[model samples]
Target: MTRLVVIGNGMVGARFVEDVLSADTAGRYDVTVIGSEGCEPYNRVLLSEVVAGKHDFSALTLPTPDSPRLTVLRGTHAVRLDREDRHVETADAARVRYDRLVLATGSDARVPGLTGLRNREGLTSGVHALRTIDDAREIVAATLNARRAVVLGAGVLGMEAACGLARRGVAVTVVHPAAALMERQLDEDASRVVESAMTGLGIDQRVGRGAVEALVAHGRLTGLLLDDGEVVPAELLVLATGTVPSTALAADAGLAVDRGVVVGDDLSSPTDHRVAALGDCAQPPEGGSGLVAQGWEQSRRLAARLCSPALSATFASGSAKAVPDRDPTSNVSDVVRLKAHGLDVVTMGVCGSQRTDDPAQRTLHLSDPDLGRHVEVVVSGGLLVGATCVGAGPVAAELVTTYTRRTPVPSDPAHLLISALTPQPRGATGSVADLPDDATVCRCNGVSKAAIVSCVHDGAATVDQVAAGTRATTGCGGCVDDVCALLAAVSTPAPGEPTDSPTTSRPREDDVTKGKHMIHSAETAGS
Candidate 1:
């Protein structure tokens, strides 16, 4: 059997291992997974939720089954990589040989070098970075007696962390350099709605300012000193600035490294075909978003290439003459949903307002500051190109579904912001039942309406069962509501309750290969 060695056993790495093993059912390869963390691979995206008491630490770990032929090494760090010998040396003084190698090293939370934030003993108490389970635990510990907390960076992580702290009755203030929260995902109007929502959540915000120093008193964090000479008193300071791809091991191994480990459309090293890189650690030629969905798609594509030679050949043949060579899976829509509770925000495709004179690339917007709701839609070539919905209730989910499925917008742009609770006028596009079977329900897992229906037909009734069977809503948890709605529609009703049939029974081609990719393409609008 061929020996396959995978390093950095995070979520993407673990998923790739499962996909390869499932495809190679004949035991064609002996797989080994090496994880840097001491325990099994866990979901890093839900760390904020864990800190907020929504889930325990144990809930973050993926419940993967054990394979007799597969070997998993926890707390083992790969120290050296000898490409010529095709082996890796771990810190535990073991040399592991491999016929193929996959790197899922992932990325690290970008921490700035602020004075008083660090000492000879490392980060001082009350100062933390929320990136891992350990980081979440430490923050929780510090919040035990913490009353006032200041979070630096108003990005997704910072805002989420701030909200989590606020939920715990900790007075939280977010300091960011951006004029608006989630500047990359939301436009000005959408951000305003988010700001209002934050206000309702009892969270304070400081925009256009950055924390220059971690204020310390006798080696304990007392507050943060901003660039504008403003001192925000706090017992805790959490830094959620951003992230940088972890490429040290790849670079030390003499592999090509730029913003990340340089790889092709197939996620293979340009110089070494035997080695592959995926997740946040890889920088594809066409570039990549630092989103978990992109990494999940790459994992699926790479798994197909490794488990079946015929599939790889087909992909190679199609891309042989393509300009600016890219992965076929890379051209899917990427939807990002903020996981903060009570914050209804979903942003997909090209967001922000369009400026071009072309009548086709028109942008429709609705901003209700009083209602704390904002919705923006950009249309190009008469199709929905991009959308952003903030504090818009159920309409956010509808907009996400429409954007992901590439569905047509109503002739009236005003209908885009209409509440889902509001009755749809006659001649409307109908409901979720109207969605095509091929319409992706779970973009993170690529589970379509047809796939979910098939699972329902096979005795998988609950959303949890469908998730276990098809792995939908497992990635970002953004599509759980849609999955539940579909389950109710397809499952047999109790007794004489009527079952609503699908509005459209048309069967479009199901590209099950690109699950998350099927939902989100990497195209951002007004970039």
Candidate 2:
């Protein structure tokens, strides 16, 4: 049997393995995945949801119950890639030989080039990056009592961070080089919506400003010095400088590099025939695609090529399936944010204001700051290219779907966004959220609703419990709210669940008292 070794078992690598097993494309592959993360494959797309208390971090999970042929080696990594020899060395110096290798070494937070961040104890604790699950947890725990936080970036991640900290009662001040939030995706009209939402959340937005350095005093972050000589004070500093492809090993191992690993349509590196890459580490066609779903698409197609004997390297673009829909659970965490205690802001597609100077795509936007509304849409040749929205009722999910799926723009033009902005009729059946169990939950983590349902039965009640129980909300935290909603669905009582039988007793532990009859054991399952 030919051996396929996958490195950096994060979202992308894990996705590749899953596609290999599930897809109908006929192939025979001996797969061995070496992941640095100790847990199962989970998402890293919505980490902000975790901070907002949307769901349990454990809900993000990818499984292989049906495929016993696959071997996933967790908490391990490909320390070195010998593309020529078709093998990789683990951090423990274990040499794993393979017929083919994969480089899914994802990116990490890019620390800014600055000064004065170092403290007297030479402590870098004050400097933080919101990249991994550990990173979000530390940021959350460290900012438990933080009075103020300085976020350096105007991108989607930065904006989300600003709102997330603010929701936790931390005074958040966003400092971005761009003049607006989500400048990459939304137009100026759409940016106004985000701006107003930020203001409502008590987030101080300072756009078109760059952080020159992180000022520190006595090993504590005092404030940040802007390029324009402005001093913004904060007790905590979050560096959302965005991520760069973590291709040091691949680059060091002599792989071709562009903005990321230059992979062909088949996800194999141009120079190394034995080596393949995906996710944040592998640059998809059209130069780059950071979305985890797209990476999974690549993984699916590649898995067919490697795992099945009927498929060969003569693959073409049309052979791959359409870009999968955004995970339904992606918004569940946010829904929890709205019903529960979280900042109610929504953004999709490109985050920042688009520039005429930039090439490709036309822009259309609507702004209503008085009502705290902003909507922006990007169009190219009558197709929804990109968009972003902020505020309570904007149709962000729809825009994201239409844009991502390359769905044709409606004839009315404004119908694409305006219809989304228009409130859905009560009892609306079709919605991005009106999904079934078979729907993928976390595109980043490859979790499903059925797996999450199993987790609910496993004693994971709260969102945090679910994250710990299933690893769902652990990654991007995007699906944190979705998982929470799912939990609510499972935990809440229906009209018929309770027997309504009279009882006489006192309060008991576990939220089920003697007289209350608060819960039904097996009866609730069907209910």
Candidate 3:
């Protein structure tokens, strides 16, 4: 059996291992995984939910793969890569040999270098960064007594964290260096609506401000001193500045490293064909979106290539064939949605802020600051190329679907923004059951309605079972309601039959329609 070693057992890394095990039915490889966290892999994307008291720590646990040929080294840190020896050295002086190596060393939460941020003990009390499960736990625990909190960033993660803390009845203030929140995804107009919505949720914002120092009192955080010489009083501080890709291991091994480990579309390092990298630690030609869905796609593609018979034959001869380059445009819809309660913000492709003056690009904008709603769509080549929607759930949902599916835009792009408000035909409710078999229900995993129904037919009755079988509702968790709706439609018994199954009871049509509205409007929009 070929030896395979994978580093960084995070969400993407773990999914890659699962994909390999699923495809390698011949038992052709012995897989070993290294995780620095000491615990089983969990969904790091939902850490904000944990902070909101929406789920317990145990709820974040991910399913572990059980196989005799697989070995997992939890709490172990890989210290060195011996390229010449074809092995990895751990911090505990252990070495693991491998014929193939995968680096999924994701990323680290970047903590800004502000005065009084750190002391002799490192990161004075009450200052925390939300990256790991442990960090979420610490933040949640602190929220019990934290009446006032300050979040130092206005990116997706920062806004989510701020809203989460506010949900816990904490007065949260978000300080951002950027003039607008989520500037990468939202333009100034859409951001204004989002800011208004967040304000309605009782979260304060200070845009275009920088944190000059963290004020500590008696070894604990008391407030943040801004560059404007203003001190915002707070008992706790959460840093959501950004993330720095963990490429030290790859760089130290003499592999190419830019912002991340440089790899080709095939995800193979130029210097070493035997070594591969994916997830946040690797920079591919198409660039990294820093989204878990993108990493999951990379993992799926790499695993497919590695398990191909052609590659297997080449590996046996101590040589490997290059995997065909993936189409750059395939799955290029980088949808970013803020998964915070009471916030409906979603953006995709080229955002409103990034729209250019090209004559061929058709752009439409609608803003209602008083109503806290903004919608913008950019059309090019008769296809929806970019969109930004804030404080408008149904509109956001429709735009996301159009953008991801590359649906042709109406001659007048205004219809794209107002179509959600237009009435549907009689008995033509928006239902998952009405969707075609090929309709994508889970954009994160690309699971189709047919795939989900197949799982239902295979005796997967609950949402969790369907997720385990089809990998739906596992990314961004935006499709759980849709999956549940489908499950009901698939499992409901015919009119005269006895309802014995737990899911045999059918949901009321009105309830289903209401659910559709809530899901499309509130549940991360699409992804």
Candidate 4:
């Protein structure tokens, strides 16, 4: 059996192991996973929810595969990579051998070089960054006594952190260098709407200025000094500045490293085919979006390639055969939705002010700052190429469906914005029952409506059962409502029928296969 060693037991790393075990049913490989965290692999995407007290640590845990040939080392750090010797050296001076290696080291929070930010030990007391469960725990504990808090940075994570602190009954102030929040995803108009919505939640914003220094006294954070020499009083400080890809291991091994570990579409290192990288740690040709869905997609494709029959034969015979090529069209999803409470913001494709000037694209927008609603769409070739919606959940949902499915829009383009006000037609966005069989309900896993229906036919009565069957509602937890709705719709029997009756009709094999293929194609079209 081939020995497979994977570094970094993050969400993507653990997912790759699960996919490999599911496909390699014949026990063709002995797998070992190295994780720096002491706990099981958990969903990092929902960390903001954890800060808001919406879920406990257990809820963030991911499922692990049961296999006799698998070994996991928790709280272990990989110190060195010996590409020539085909082994990895852990911090304890132990060596783990491998025939193939996958690097999922993920990323580290980037703390700027502000004065008084760090002490002799590390970050000064009461200053924390929300990148791990420990960080969230610290932030939560601090919130219990913190009367005021300041968040540095106005990106998605920053905004989420601010809202979470406010929800805990703490006065929150956000300081960002950019003039508008989420400038990369939203234009000025949409930003104003989002700002207004946030203000309604009692959160204060100081945009176009950055935090210059940390005001610490007695080894505890007291406030943040802005660039304009203004101090925002606070007892706790949360830094959501950004993240840097954890590429030191790859770079130390003398591999090609750019902004991240440079890899091809296959996610294999150019210098060493035996080594591969994915998640936030690797930079592919299409670039990394720092989204969990993109990492999950990469994990899926890499797992497929490593478990293919062709590669297994090559490994057995010691031949130089190249791995089979993947479908070139498979692209990662670019959808960005904020997971904060009382905030409805979603953006996808080409957005912001820069793209509106494209002569080839048709743009339409409706702004209502008084009501805190803004909707914008960029259409080209009769397709929804870009969209930005704030404070409008229903319209945002419809636009997301259209954008992801590449569904043709009405000729006028105004209908895309106006249709949400009227009753939606059949197979439209309002009701789960009206969605077409092929419409995707879970964007994170790319699971379609028909797939959920098929799972119901196979006796999946609950959301957990359906998740176990189709892997829906597992990522981001944004699709739980849709999955529950579909389950209720399919599990409900005809009038006067028994309540516990099983679904009588099952989807045809051909139909299921075709639906899967179509979903795959839609996912990979713009790669």
Which number leads on TM-score? 3
lDDT (C-alpha) at residue 421 in model 3: 54
Candidate 1 regions exceeding 4 Å error are: 317-333, 352-360, 410-422, 425-434, 494-527
Task: Write down the TM-score of every candidate.
Answer: 0.87, 0.74, 0.91, 0.90
lDDT tens string, model 4, 212-283? 899999999999999899999999999999999999999999989998999987789999999999889999
lDDT of each residue in 126-152, candidate 2, tens digit only: 667888887778888977767888888
The local distance difference test score of each candidate is 0.74, 0.63, 0.81, 0.81
lDDT of 3 by residue, 1-527 (tens): 99999999999899899988977878889999989999999988888888987767886788878999899999999999999899999988899999999999999999888988898977889999999999999999999898999999988889889988998999999999887888888877777788888899999999888999999888888999998999999999999989999999989999999999999877899989999998989999889878887787778677867887665444344331222222222243377777788888878878845667889888888899998888888889999888788777777767766776566788888888777757668787678788767667777777778888888878876666787898877777777778878977888897877787644655456544443432231222234
Model 2 residue-pair collision total: 45
Ranking by TM-score: 3, 4, 1, 2
lDDT of 1 by residue, 1-527 (tens): 89999998888898888878887867788998888898888877778877777767876787565788689999988998899999999999899999999999988888799999899988887888888889999999888999999988876677778878887889989898877787877766677788888889998888878778888888899988888999999999898888899999889988999999999988999878899999889998768677676777677678778877776676566551121112223224356667665576777777643233666677778788898878787777656777787776467667666665556777765566654538768878755556777666666566667877787777765556677888875666555556656665655364565544342222212312222222121121100
Q: Which residue pairs clash in candidate 4?
A: 329-524, 330-524, 331-524
Error of 1 at 495 (Å): 7.2
lDDT of 3: 0.81
